[model samples]
Target: MNRFYDIINKIENNNNEITVSEYFHRCIAQAINENEKELVDWFCKIKNDVEGELVAWAEKHGQKYILGRNRAERKTWGIQVLLGKKIKYKDTVLNIYFPTEFHENSIIVEQCF
Candidate 1:
């Protein structure tokens, strides 16, 4: 089985005992602690793909945006910004950092590993 699926299954099976968030945190923390490159690389690729999708969406909608990485409070991750006048997408403003928590947590997790 793919390690990713294995991790998901493990999370699902124990969903009754812990919240999905907690399970995911534990899995990633363990993976990082053990220096699991395959899983880590998988996560990095997913992050990159997510950033790409966000950038593509911004461009498709005629928004001027920049994609790059930023470090704040000692956490680093890819970031995308919709520049110029404030643009509203549905109910929220688009001038916000993307994937703030996931990437930030991953940065914080790296230190524990």
Candidate 2:
């Protein structure tokens, strides 16, 4: 299986806070190294879609949290997706913190591996 898929599968299996972030960061790093342009573009698009979905969901549910400007910027051919939350990347793991407070959310990050 692709590395990204494997990471996502691991995240789904664990469903823990730290694990999710680690998996996401590792997957994003791999995606950045493998196909910089495509991953960057796709991340930019997906980030926007996710923000919109989160906003609509929050509005319907009367949530007070804000959906800030989520953007994916490229730096030296590396793609970084900046949400309101912060993500830390290491050699072996990627850490992500979910913005929602109610339920666990799953993100399907697709890219060529």
Candidate 3:
């Protein structure tokens, strides 16, 4: 029962699906508090590595990948089409689609892992 879990719960409550960055940051902080920094770091690193595959895939599809604070943000960027396609990287889950393109305001990816 620490503030880390509180923050994570708050994030989950705020959104139906948590973003990669949100998950990554929260778990990292929690791990440190629990003296499991290495474990959390390893978890996140694998998550990112898995995401990298999606990133490359998106690039080949021509649809831009946009990361945002909410679903609305993705809509604003016209990348809302890239949703629902969950990508699993080891134990982490990315609750969105990975596009295969990028422009100036193309994708706003969550940068945590």
lDDT of 3 at 72: 15
Error (Å) of candidate 1 at residue 33 is: 3.3
Instruction: Name the regions of candidate 2 deviating beyond 4 angstroms.
Output: 1-15, 18-27, 66-113
lDDT of 1 at 71: 14
User: For residues 1-113, what per-residue lDDT tens digits would candidate 2 score against the true structure?
Assistant: 23434333332322122222333354556567667555445445545654555466446645445344222332232233333333432221112222233423434332211
**What lDDT score is found at residue 93 in candidate 1?**
14
Candidate 3 clashing pairs? 58-99, 58-100, 59-100, 65-107, 66-107, 66-108, 67-108
Question: Each candidate's lDDT (Cα)?
Answer: 0.37, 0.38, 0.40
Q: TM-score of the candidate numbered 1?
A: 0.34
Where model 1 places Cα greater than 4 Å from the true spot, the runs are 9-30, 63-113
On a 0 to 100 scale, what is the lDDT of residue 18 in model 1? Answer: 32
Summing lDDT over every window of 10 consecutive residues in candidate 3, give the lowest-scoring window. 72-81
Worst 10 residues of 1 by lDDT: 69-78
- Tell me the spans in candidate 3 whose CA falls farther than 4 Å from its real position: 1-13, 67-113
In angstroms, give how far residue 24 of model 1 lies from its true place.
Answer: 9.8
Please name the candidate that would achieve the greatest TM-score relative to the true structure.
3
